[model samples]
Target: MARELLPGQSPELLKALHILTRDGALNADSLRKLKQVNHLVRLLAPAIEDVLARFGDPVLVDCGAGKSYLGFVLHELFLRPAGKGSLHAVEARPELVAAAEALAARLGADRMRFERAAIDAAAPPARVHLVTALHACDTATDDALALAVRHGADHVAVVPCCQAEVARQLGEAAAPAPLLAPLFEHPWHRREFGSHLTNVVRALALRASGYAVTVTELAGWEHSLKNELILGRKVRASDRAAEDRLLGLCAAAGIRPKIVRLLFPAGAPAP
Candidate 1:
């Protein structure tokens, strides 16, 4: 008997994403992975629905889209029914882009487009309602945040990965004796601290850029190391305190990020 997914469920997408076997059975680990993906979609679904309710249709840009799993699943479940929105998957790897394009074509997902470009270099489209990045590595996640801000996107969702740059930089600097010694004694401690700093700075940056931010644990920390989702929505205008804290965090870490300049321009007041 042929396997079939319930209508509106995304079994085909899971197979296309290589998250499931051909026999339609999810293994112990695959189940965890699928759960995470499902939970992420669920978490973002309300926001998407809310936006659709307020504004007609929304354009979503998924950065570091990899094989476009999130894009495909989202389009299958959310954008398809609405029939008014589009999805753009931004990825730097040509092979992954090609694979995503093929899967999208096979799935008849006409509303989606796969672009081969890093988020930093991606050209701005007219309007984007939502921006998402799942496990985008290190500072690349920052680049995605900057892109979302540049486009004036209404919602920004990010899961950061492999935060090494800030940690390495922080290691070179001196922390206070007790805290500094223990933190620097082990490489892993330094990495963890860097990860923490990265997220904190990112949150502050988003707040400064006028977006209300929420940091939450993604459903699958055991399945994947990068399991924190940072969700932000534009609430009001730029916040001075957020910008000031962002600059202060950058200075303290000694890792100067270009996103700081982009998010908080020269004329902006200090936070």
Candidate 2:
């Protein structure tokens, strides 16, 4: 049963995305979905405003946009007639891409475009002002973050999922058998360790690449276990010491990332 959305409470785009259902009522699933989107929007609001102030009509790209839930909800709630910004969604899944495209068309959201592409390989339009990736898996989040850094995005928002890459890296590093053997044996332990290591490296990498990073819990844990949202802004330059340390961590883990070098040219000092 779908309950009607409260007046002035639900965003039309969210309704179309099925977060509100046909009747607008939010169920247990819808409630979780809404919380995630709402948290992201709140975090990005100030950054979006700042970008708009600088670049008349900012362009935003959503990578790994699984069904484009963020895109639809954002457009409905924030983007307006007076706002000339557009949202381009990059999704690898063909069905999701098609569904998102149809939904955008049905809603007359001319500014929204959905394309099929992996996060690592996505080529966005020239001059993107913002880049967002919600629940992008493992290194895919890094891929999206790399894109944001390369494109000089005014802002970037990411909620990461599945830290397998980092876990693998962590596993390769030598540690006491008594402590580390258990992590490798237990699925939950591996996931917890990997999640922590992934975010720590990511924050350091962003700082090394000239972005100020802020990490916070996105909504509540009930929304999802992958609830950490890392918000990055290009208000400051990179730090050479941080860059060295970041590279050192990769070296220590024996995993060579494609982003470190691209973001920090010649290992130059932070400007």
Clashing pairs in 1: 240-271, 241-271
Candidate 1, 13-108: lDDT as tens digits: 787787676666888766766777778888998778876777776789999999888898888888888887888899999999998898788889
Off by over 4 Å in 1: 1-7, 174-186, 265-271
Task: Give Cα-based local distance difference scores for all models.
Answer: 0.79, 0.74
The numbered model that scores best in lDDT is 1
> What's model 2's overall lDDT?
0.74
Clashing pairs in 2: 3-25, 5-24, 238-270
Per-residue lDDT of candidate 2, residues 162-184 (tens digit): 77865665555554235345654
* Candidate 2 deviant stretches above 4 angstroms: 1-12, 174-190, 253-271
Q: Write down the TM-score of every candidate.
A: 0.88, 0.84
Give the RMSD in angstroms, all C-alphas superposed, for model 1: 3.6
Best-performing candidate as measured by TM-score: 1
